[model samples]
Target: MLGLDKKDFTLLLIVSALVLLAPLLLNPFPEGSAMAQFNAGYPDLMQRFVIFGIFAIGFNILFGLTGYLSFGHAAFLGAGSYAGMWMLKLLSMNVIPAIIFSTLIAGAISFLIGWISLRRSGIYFSILTLAFAQMAFVLAASVLTPITGGETGLQPALSDPRILPEFLGGGSVTADGNIPKPSLFGIEMTASSEVAVGNWLWTLNWGYYLSGFMMLVAFYIAIRIFRSPFGLMLKAVKSNQQRMSYTGLNTRPYMLACFVISGMYAGLAGGLMAAMDPQVGAERMQWTASGEVVLMTILGGVGTLIGPVLGAGLIKYFENIFSKINKATLEVWFGVFPDWMTDLMVTIVYPFIGKGWHLTLGLMFMAVVIFLPGGLVEGGQKIAKLFSRKKEPETPGGEAKPAE
Candidate 1:
């Protein structure tokens, strides 16, 4: 189905189901409930979930399959965001053109960077990419102040001329003199519909749906690439680039292509981010931003099709949900206990949440690395294996039967 084998097609369906049903899945608690604070069905965090998922998915193509760990991939994301912002400012408030331009610009930048960085493999290449990213960051933050808005950042302005809207028979400026929000034709990205079921509330966001759709497409494409000869070549490069070189095979082109494709994915993610918020900052290109995606990929399960998406979702959940758990919130949860007990409980768990969520993430990462090197996916597989082993029937000689 959809050019995918049974397992891959099943995986695709599962992902699709998850993305489409995330609102319900992420919001299991009733509205106004104490646990409702952990609900992630809101548009902002949901959008981040998919946007970063796309970013990590792209990074996995390079780092996961090809063994090329880029320490500066966020440069492409930041570049794409800037490009998208420019599109919003100069062109119509439509997101399509901005997204297209973002991908193209990021691809071009990645091409230039890859052309130079791919010359050296391993740590040398990583350092080169990092240096270029740092240079880009500095330029965007300072040297390119006029264009990037310097430290002030870039966002839509009320007075700027949006030529496309004028040609489309609409005035660019709002009658209220407010900046226009990004949209698909007339549907604003911030627009959403809400449905109330009993005590539960669900928000269906247009922007999130759009981003989710793009993520689905991106995932499908990644699956195709992973199953193709190109993906095998990338795996080979990871396994032994020197061997392929000895066989007179030119591998630089493949590496560059993979790098550009990955950048395009990151670019699309950045573009969607701008479409949702219509803002750009030089901080988007920081090395920490790049490292975050690497961590997402590694934590989710690098080299596996669905691993990065899981990782991205996990990290975003920690960032959004766990980080929001404060003393007051914890006090409320433990309110039923004695005052001393509540205070003690808060003290015990305080360090892992509310401004120290990174500690929890670090601990989880360490556990994954030391125990399950394959990430959460491997952990899941091990659990499944255990259950399956228990389910197997015993043979006549008191041994488990091995049946096909």
Candidate 2:
């Protein structure tokens, strides 16, 4: 297939199918049904799934392959986001320029940070990254207030100059004098169409498809990197960087390169987010945001292709569906039960839903770490093995042989 071995090719096909059909797959429950609350086929949520999938995929490159657990990758994401926002404000509403400039700026920032941070390894390196991220957050919120818009964040306004439109022989302002939304050529990012299939409604979103396409490309690149010789070197670095250093192998450049690449990935995700929403906030660079990617990679299966995407979807699903289960929703779900019984059920389950969704996530993370250290992928493999039938040995007559 696409230069990949049969297994990798099959995996790629499966992912493509999933991404293409996500609106249908994520909306299995019929509209207005009780279970519809769990449906995540909406444009906003779908975009988040693929965008964060890209983030986790990039984080996995450095953490999974090179054993560099960054605690500040979100800085790159934030930087890219600001860059994208600037492009949107000063250039045109078209998302292409913003995305490209976002990537390049983030890569450059990563290169500088990696050059300094890669000097140390282990917890020290992790601490340095965290410090850098926190510094960026503070700077964005305070010192860089003029550029970042401080606590309010940066967003486009109709009054601002957009030179690209003028250069292209068009007015930047619409006839209605509204701030333009991000778009691809003539298509708006928020544009969507709906199809009704019986009681089910599916939303086909331009932004989601665009983000999904980017995610697929990012995934393919990650797969190639994983299977490449450079990927092999990264794995070797993970196994024994100190030994490689003793052997006169300059591991620093490899680590720095991986770090910059990972940062660029984060930046791209941030740019996509801005293109969708056209806003950039300092909060995007917080250490917690960086930690979330780490959790996504670990929960899905670090170093394994497709694990980060799976993990990202799971977490996003939890954030959207589980967190939305309020008392009213829970009551509706348990309406068939007796009043007292329904109340009891809600009381017991309430803590794990709504505001306490993180508790559920924490418990799940703990269970996976304890029981399935290889993450959800290992559990899936185990289930697959259990369902698979073992072939018995055959005799020369082509009949099953009896056990000796």
Instruction: At residue 112, give the lDDT of candidate 1.
Output: 99
lDDT of 1 at 110: 99
Task: State TM-scores per candidate.
Answer: 0.94, 0.93
- In candidate 2, stretches whose alpha carbon ends up further than 4 angstroms from where it belongs are 166-171, 335-340, 389-404
lDDT by residue for model 1 over 1-404, one digit each (tens)? Answer: 99999999999999999999998899999999978989999999999999999999999999988999899999999999999988888888889889999999999999999999999989998999999999999999999998888888999887767788544313467767777788888788999999999999999999999999999999999999999999999999999999999999999999999999999999999899988998899999999999899889989999999999999998999899889989999998889999999999999999989899998888888878787778888877766676677765552332222110
lDDT by candidate, in order shown? 0.91, 0.89
Worst 10 residues of 2 by lDDT: 395-404
> Number of clashes in every candidate structure?
0, 0
Which candidate number maximizes lDDT? 1
Writing each residue's lDDT as its tens digit, candidate 2 over 1-404 gives 77799999899999999999999999999998878888999999999999999999999999999888899999999999999999888888888888899988999999999999999999999999999999999999999999999999999888767787643322467768777788888688999999999999999999999999999999999999999999999999999988888999998888888998898998899999999998888999989999888888888888889989999998998998889889998898888999999999999999989999999888888877777767778777765564454444332332221110
RMSD of 2: 5.9
Q: Give the best candidate by TM-score.
A: 1
